[model samples]
Target: MTDENTTVPARPRGGLLRYVVAATLARTADGGAVVAIVLLVTASGDPGWLAGALGACITAPHLLGPFVARSLDTTRDGRRVIALASVVHGATLAAAVLLYPSTHAIVPAALLIASGLLGPLLTGGISSRLPAIAGPSRTSQRRAQGWDVATYGVGGTVGPTIVAAVSAWASPHTSALVLTLGTFIAAGFVMLLPYSPPASDARDVPRPARTLVVMFSSGPLRRTLYLTMIVAFSVAALPIAAVASTDQLGTDDAAAGVLTAAYGLGNLAGSIGVMARPLEGNADQLMTRLATLVATTLLAVALAPSFSLATAAYAAAGIANGYFFAATLAARNEYAPSEIRGQVFVWTGALKITAGSTGTALTGAIVGTAVHLPLVLAIALTTAAALTSASERRFVTRQVRAADHVQPGTVRRD
Candidate 1:
């Protein structure tokens, strides 16, 4: 059944541009916090463990994503919820900046965790609103998703650059303050968004656990989630492999930096390409192809004889990474039920973050043992993702064909 509240009016001439700007700012705030925190911790002469602790604090709130999204789902006006979250997020960041000089760890930790709780407003919340802004056209939605992915790439690249540049000229505290101000600006942008409230339906809302169960029970969504996690793990391992490649080449750490930048450039290029011309094929199939490309490139990087070769391979992998991200978002929109779509997006984001964090820690532990181990492991994971996608496709196709063959009046029991 179509939900009237969810249906966007015919495309307004400049509606999409407004949403793009809002989403970009939101992503910038998200990425800026990460860069600002790292600089802040480093400049304070804190132990490495403090930095790690801060990272955990930032990511820990994501564990509550489903619950948060559930609450949002209960409300008709998601935009208001998102706007409020953004304000709270900005306020907490501002508080963290003001309290940075305190000797106690608890104050900063608590503030950071409070800010992190609003991360979904910037990420999945914005994404969930895309369909509304893009109207009912599939092409428009695809373009919007592509732009969304590109904004993420841009934010990740620009946020660190801004923090690093400011920190170089001034103090890390100054950079943190700047980022805190930026968060407020982002909140302003979010509040300006024109999304209508999702239409309330008569269907019963499932409990969070039941919603999760229904989501995972769907073949396509399950495969997509698995693919997202595997790809995230591989992407996280890239930095570990980049460091190892520098060691293998007996080169300066600058080589690793260059390699990392190469990947980012490729990711940006791929995202732009998708924005210009969206992928053509089944979402699952496109995802499978992209995962295969990532796996193959990682394998090549592992075997690369020179730093140059490794850099090229990593960049290639990153291009595939960008496309894969877009495909997965599209898949989520395609496969998830409307009632729980927000939860699904938030859940997916949390899982990807968790997988990436876990992969980074694992890679750190093992990369010292073998220069190529991280890349090899990444390749294995991507390969498994591809296989899983292929299996899902076959299973779904069988189910469709079987249903087609069944008599009209008779129900077939599985």
Candidate 2:
């Protein structure tokens, strides 16, 4: 007879492939739009300030991700909602493309902002469905999350490359149109995916304020968010540092692109590795270790004597960064309750975007300083985050052990 505790492995679901492809296309469109917008604005003879404003407009709606994702949580058919949003977002991009050249700044900017408002459907909505797609097993969920991270990395890398290649050969307008087409294709795939809304549990539901409180109350969740924010800030400093490093080393601007590509390649490799060899030990501990590795790599980048060494260091940092992302996602899956998982995912995305944008802005202000200063600052911030994670781990361990000793039916006050 089979042991009562044994679990049979779940058969892989085919819908998962469709979901991954759809999500990847959405992300690629989103990433390509960034590069396309810059190129289009520049080609239209707009000032740098206008391009920056448009970029901010595109990203600003992501700050409302939690609120926007609430509709997804409440809807009876999440796939339909996601598909509809994707279509609308794509249409907005198409409109922007048509109006980019001769139209006033306000028109395209408004269109871009409309698309941004639908961003949560593409990101958090899709991610929240991973558990359902991969079955109820923890191992399957972890593997699905790893694949999600890898897909996102691939989309980000491919999107910018497509824009660069198209803009060099054709025009930015063509690139924008291509990206808009991608979104439409993604919408079609989303509609084809087999998704059924999860059964509602009244006991699982919590008020938004209560949800926020609970998320922050968990040591693991709180520490994960903090660590993600710190890492995001550091990552934002990379581009500026890349440009500065090329100049300091007497290399052409192409060197900056090469360094960025190296980092992206490393991220892709690390994400794939996570899928192949699952992480062991507590999720929180694994995340802390990865964050520490990122810090060490950043420090090496700061002190590198040559551009070649700096590129390798950045690549190493990227590997750690990718693994940290996978670990953080796993931690959230393990720690967050089912009802509020969507909110948590969207909230984390918003926070990381805000932090990274702020870091980029600040780094821009100090770009004239020493070339390595931003990397040094990133090292300090990441190191602090690692230490914070360690302290939180100890506190959580103590709390768990104390709870274990409490007798049944006795009031155990903290």
Candidate 3:
């Protein structure tokens, strides 16, 4: 099964750059939206509850991502859906802008939530298009994934700064509108990219619902899902810790942002590294090691006595994070039936969002208490690593079986 790279796309590096650029622009709005919402809520002086509501809005769409991704079968249909989503997303943002005058918070929040709820379909549409654009080669597909991850890394690194700058000059509502406009522009750019649907004869013909359910049934995928969730939770620790350390230890907001940026920079570098080489070994082994590295580094970050040490720890954590993201995606790609790839990916997105929200909640609850922040994070990460290792072992066994059944001699011929 691992050797079955037949259906994967093959495209030149140049083609990937076009998609990458589009991806960068596409994600910019999403990232910028995060900052805009955060600032808006912070400025409203209801940071805790409003921020939590915003987080719910953003993560809620992911819950249905797996379900919606089942529709990514037809290239034409997928493209139309993406374009329509872009328009709707823009309209919702405009609503937010107008409703800002109400000052009741509920109306603007409804608009924000609506905008977020529609994002999965748009994102799923894009992922489906990637395979088409990349062609039928494993290398090309990997590169495409690399490009997407790189764009994500870049956007994450700079998104907050952009929001801060905009808010400083304008208002949060204006910034939100600006970000929405950018989303529409990116959607147009992506629409211009060439794509050909899987040939009708070659396309997967399974019942869409059944195929989607199968994604969660796979042992490797389940393990991956669990690990991804933990990684999401772990994500909250760094930024929260950085801010607290600075607030309590006299580190400036600028310093905290620098540390965060360093982590993102590391993620950018790691994406390139994964793209440069194919993942050929045991998927479980790779993920376990990376998860352990991330946890260990986070522990170190928690224990650091100075800003510089914390910065380095965060950067190292980012590198581990980058590797984990790439490796997990590659593994998911390798194992998932091409027919259901979008469903799997969108579900992964949901898992990531929920895990992150959980992590943030935990961080907020424990940071000011009797528990030492480093110890708490270290324990969470270490537990995650152990859990990941166990799940990966089970996952590898199932993958080996799945691989065996796919080989010519293994399954009984009809």
Candidate 4:
């Protein structure tokens, strides 16, 4: 008879690294898509309004991403989801290249939204498969997550540079074509990866009751998620602010693009920093401070009288945002149970996307009309962050207690 008191260790499956690499390549496709749309509209000299409209349209699918990602929870075949989503994303990019301008703005806008919808599905589906890939070691799982973030950062930095060079050397249309081809390449890579569903696949899973419960089980996690949402929204807001600042500075869009690039640079730096020295000892307290720092910097950007000051402030915001994101995610991986991790992560992405899209839309509406757009946004973020900070310490302590009960060896193995 099998030993009743002992849990058997599962096999350490191979090809996880392949999946990671493929996922990174797929992410590069997303970055190229962003660049293709931005350059195409800007090159046309159709004014900033069209650019912003396109962005909002592209991101609209995120509003439905949570609902879409739920399918992964009910299904055991995560690999199929990832594979099909990749193909769809590739096809959508191809369609965008062939049809965006010729088919009218609305048609392309809808296509972009459909492409955006694939992201959350891919994210949720892959995360659900991690347990199979990482086996039983919690540390191994965390390491995998860290590596994934690193890959994403590297791809994000490289994609725009390539797009800029290609657009300059050829044209926006050529860049779009390149993006379409890149997506197809990425899809091919993903198809070659192995499939590994979690051992929990045999067990019955519950439907998600609510978004809040999905993301906010641990107090610290909830607080961190809120901070992250704000930061992401601020990211969406940065381009708007950059454009305004460039106009104020009597410079070209290149200046604004520089500031935007600086923000992404800061994000990469922050992600690297977090991975190098993981959040330890009072993680929630540290994140609270970082959130406060981000809020204060946003406020500073709002009040800045000069273009250089605003640019610096935006960079600072990006750094704080990245640090908070990485550290908080590390903490969540430690806190959330493996079975529900995908659900939580799915909602987290949903919140980030929703907040980001809303931020862009709100800022787009307000920046030109409002006297001090940055100041207003700053105040909003500061107030939300301050409330979160005050609650963080208590939240962390409570979560620690909860984790003590739920951690491996404390509860019966599933």
Give per-residue CA lDDT, model 2, range 55-126, as digits (tens): 777788877767767655566767777788888888897798788767888998999899887776677667
Q: Against the unseen true structure, what C-alpha lDDT does each candidate score?
A: 0.79, 0.80, 0.68, 0.66
Sorted on lDDT, highest at the top, how do the candidates line up? 2, 1, 3, 4
lDDT value for model 4:
0.66
Residue 258 accuracy (lDDT) in model 1: 86
Report the C-alpha lDDT of model 4 over 1-414, residue by residue, as the tens digit. Answer: 123344765554555676667666666766667777878888878678887777665556655666666556555665666777877876776687678577778887777888888866555445545545644444454445555566556666666777788899998878767766665666665656555554355355545556457456667667767776777676677778788777666678788887777777777766666656544545566667776777777777676677777677777877777776655565555555555656666667667768877788788888888646754775678567757667766666688998876887665566
Candidate 1 residue lDDT tens string, 70-99: 755667778777777777787787687678
Off by over 4 Å in 1: 1-8, 406-414
User: What TM-score, computed on C-alpha atoms, does each candidate reach?
Assistant: 0.92, 0.91, 0.82, 0.76
Top model number, lDDT: 2
* Candidate 3 clashing pairs, residues 3+ apart or interchain: 8-136, 8-137, 9-135, 9-136, 9-137, 10-135, 10-136, 10-137
Candidate 4 has its poorest 10 consecutive residues by lDDT at 1-10
Give the per-residue lDDT of model 3 (tens digit) for 1-414.
Answer: 324545534444455566676666556666677677767777877657777677466556656555555555534346665666667776886687567646677787788777776666555446556766765556656666666677777766555667788889988877777777777776776667675564343245355457656866786676676777787688666676676677554577778777777788878877888788744566656667777777777777767777787778778888788888766776667676666666666677666766776787788788787335734764576566657567667767798998877886565776
Per-candidate RMSD, Å: 3.4, 3.4, 4.9, 6.6
TM-score of structure candidate 2: 0.91
10 residues in a row with least lDDT, candidate 3: 199-208
Clashes of 4: 0
- By the TM-score metric, which is better: model 1 or model 3? 1
Model 2, residue 304: distance off in Å is: 1.6
